[model samples]
Target: MLKKLYGKLEISINALESWMKERKNLAGLLVGIVILGGLIGCAIWLNQPVEGEVPTSASQMAYEKASVTAVLEDGAVPDYEDAEGRRVGTQELEIRILTGTHKGEIMSLTNYMSALFNVDVEKGDQIIVRIMTDEDGSYYASLFNYNRGIVLGVFVLIFFILLAVLGGKKGLGALLGLLFTLASIWFVLIPCLIRGIPAIAATVGIVAVTAAGALVLLNGFSLKTLCSVLGCVIGVVAAGGIAALVGNITPMNGFNMPEAENLLLYGADKGMKISGLLVCGVLISALGAVMDVALGIASSIWELHEQNPSLPGRALFRSGMHIGRDAMGTMANTLILAFAGSSLNMLILVQTYDIPFIQLINTDYICIEIIQSVAGALGILLTVPIVAFISARLMARGKRVS
Candidate 1:
């Protein structure tokens, strides 16, 4: 009788534990759903057009997707003497509009192709046409460009499929997190900046929100997530601060950027702050690398603590530092290379002209690029220690209590 009672007790405890585990998982799912819904709501609210905001003239122009039903003529004139010569000519095409108000309308269009702006197309190729409406209710159409949307869509679909197949549940979470980050930037950050919010502050706020959301989605609400988020935010902010300081010292503001003139012309009257945009750019560019380092350190430390709960905080800290050091070199190099690759054209120009080193270093564009690369690398470097320290303390303390 005693033996039977003991077996029954053991089975009952096991069943209860399983039930509690399922309940916990269900609760987590509910929480995740609620959070996702809230984020979507906020994104929608932020994306709404602001009252009194004037639309650009370009927005009034209509572009429609169309297919080249027939290529009526192809005239090409090529320059033989110039090494960089390109074909410049025009093609007459009959197209059928596939979208917008003119859907299924067949029309003849002229496609002017030049060395600088060209879209070579064959029959059945999808393209975009610019439609201009006259006061008399008549419309004229011209070739704008090739409609590459379908191709881009296919590429993106493949990317998602691979991510899902390789990453499984975690991959889906990452996909959601990526969408959330994009929404935060497009809906929240851009609008805030347009509304004249301090660029640096708005960027920082958005970074923090995105970082928190992504980490939570990936790891759930946990000590490791907290540590990672905190470390990431601090590292990003530090990078921005460094960049800002350098910009101030060099007297290089956003006006020194290539697109500054256009921005000033178009956005200054719309209450956009231009001066801090440089720092804002630095923060955004460094965010991914910094976050990677922070999460890596925090997760490693947490796993170490889990494997050996009795490990002291100092020992965990050392392990995290070791892991961080291994990551630091490669991550820093990644940031520098990314910045350099973006400016490859300028580098080529300098080399082609055989520009003096002094002149090259003093150029505003080069200085800005250097500042961006250095600040980002420094951010990654600092993030390692910060995340290591935070994760070590938190994980070790949690272990002792448990």
Candidate 2:
């Protein structure tokens, strides 16, 4: 099966019109994606609550600070109590609906209403929120904003349009690759894990499936696709091994992650291995960078081959390695800077307190973020060289089949 598929890849397209047809097909695909996404958005909007339905409200959204307000009436007794039986102060929050069918409604919200929050609310601070509303007009926020879907839809629209304009038919292939990735992760990986499959094995399997589907669908089943798949698989395994070793030696309270920690606290009673779940998180987080490193090196080798098909394996390996070196430097920096940018404010608090190195690095949140950045970086660095080295060995030993 692999031989037959590989043979087709080597057979060049002989007709110019076929290439144009591919372009038209891709253009149609982009249009279809945008239309489908827009339809979904419209469906969601239409199905949203009608007037006098329970008003959906959120607190300091889009930022980390809580929302607070003082009632106009003096001496409003606070209704919330903390763990120590001390009356936790309440701040009156004036809320307005920003979007949806119920666009204009004023409501009052508060901070410290739930045990999940710690930040003090103020007049102006933004935080992500999840809101809950019943079928009735009554509503109370469980968190901040409940509807991220609206924003997600807008971004999807922009992405499909941009892809259509940018690469035409190839863009369509990329889009298909993306949709397939999302589908497999949600449908195949998550279901397999929930059904008692080993998390590590499931992760490896999904990565393998995703990498092959994406690379083949984009580059076709050829040398380029082979190198990328092989590279990505190695990187994923390295990441899984590193995560497992680190987790075994120094297990934290593990609330360093969200649901995993909660599940751990609960799972201990049920005798489930929550540590396995944590390892899964680390593996999943590293998957993106692994694919990036693999594809980057493989694609560079392919482009080099196209430019000079007669180039020897040694030179092709060197080309891939050089390109990978440059890519790794920027990509690793990108991952770190992205983390720093997201946590700039928390970092400010660390700086303000002159936090001792021991306390700062040991902090649970900081530790987890570091794990995310560093593990991914290590995987990426290792992948670039591995892909280049193996591709060279394979190509050098082979005579191009006529």
Candidate 3:
């Protein structure tokens, strides 16, 4: 029975290999299509609007676009000021709704000219209006903001067009991989966390799957993919481990992040582990940088081995180490700078408040940022040599055996 099973398994592997070889070009295309289709399905499923019970006495609200029909009045209200040290006032304007149920309906709105959060409008200006109705059917409208979606949409269109034109097939693959990464996080990772799965375990599994899937899709199922995936796994795990250890020993709380207090309140109520989540964040933050280094080292080793198929294992390892050292310099800087950029405002606050050096260093927020940034950089640094060694061994496998 065992022999028969082995025979069947061997036959299945051979058949699948033969089938893939016959449709080599179609395989990558099909993979991309399947991933993209799954992403669209996830988006549709997540965004399906659910009908809720309507409140009978609640105010009705709707957003609409409008065009300023005319400036009816302008005067100083003494409640607001302009940037030029002049007292600003209210401006009343007649406007016509261009969208929503109020299309073509004319109305009037008052704009209080404030230095901030107010839009000064004139005739022919396009604007957004927020309509609110009382239970007695009385309604009021206010200027919401300017219509900015068109500008944003144009920029998005330009980005995709440039990606396609510049990157060709690889660009499509990259886009698909990006979509997959996002879907996995939104659909899989978050849901699992909400369901009370341990954060570290869930993060490790999700990241490993993401790394492998993305690498295979980008590089195909080759030694390069394997090397990169393995390296990423080690790096991410190491980063998480370091974060967990440091967080436990230090006085820092996971509440150092924005909105973390709310999350902690909710998460604690749900029995979620804030410390684990913090470590998970550190792991994920470092993941992209580590994956970059892994890919860089693996590709270099693969290229070197390809050029000298009979190169000695020691020689290949040495070459990989040399390449990794060069990559580590910039990759470490990338991780550190990325963290610093995100916390630039907070850093400025410390300086602005005249925080002492020792106090600033011991502060929970700054310490958390330091741990996250340093741990991630350390992960990248470690992944380099690990990837270099593994890739060299695997790429030089046949040569070494011969």
Best by the TM-score measure:
1
Model 1, CA-based lDDT: 0.87
lDDT of each: 0.87, 0.65, 0.79
TM-scores for every predicted model = 0.90, 0.62, 0.77
lDDT of 1 by residue, 58-149 (tens): 99999999999998998966755552566678888999999999999999988887766878889999999999999999998988888889
lDDT of 2 by residue, 283-316 (tens): 6777777777888887777666666667788898
Error of 2 at 344 (Å): 2.7
The Cα RMSD of model 3 versus the native structure comes to 7.2
User: In candidate 3, what are the lDDT values of residues 1-402, reduced to their tens digit?
Assistant: 999999999999989977876586476557756865765675466444335633333234588889999999987444423355543678888999999887989999888776566576779988988998877988878988987777889998898778767888767666666666777888877765654678889889878877877777667766688899999999989988888888888855566666688777655655566656778888788888888889888888888887879987778889889989988889889988988899899889978999899998887777888888888888988898899888877787785221
Candidate 2, clashing residue pairs? 54-137, 60-127, 61-127, 63-126, 63-127, 69-92, 129-144, 129-145, 130-143, 130-144
Supply candidate 2's per-residue lDDT for 51: 60
> Which ranges of candidate 3 are over 4 A from the true structure?
1-71, 74-89, 93-105, 118-137, 264-273, 399-402
Candidate 3 clashes between residue pairs 3 or more apart in a chain or in different chains: none
State model 3's lDDT: 0.79
Give me candidate 3's TM-score against the actual structure.
Answer: 0.77
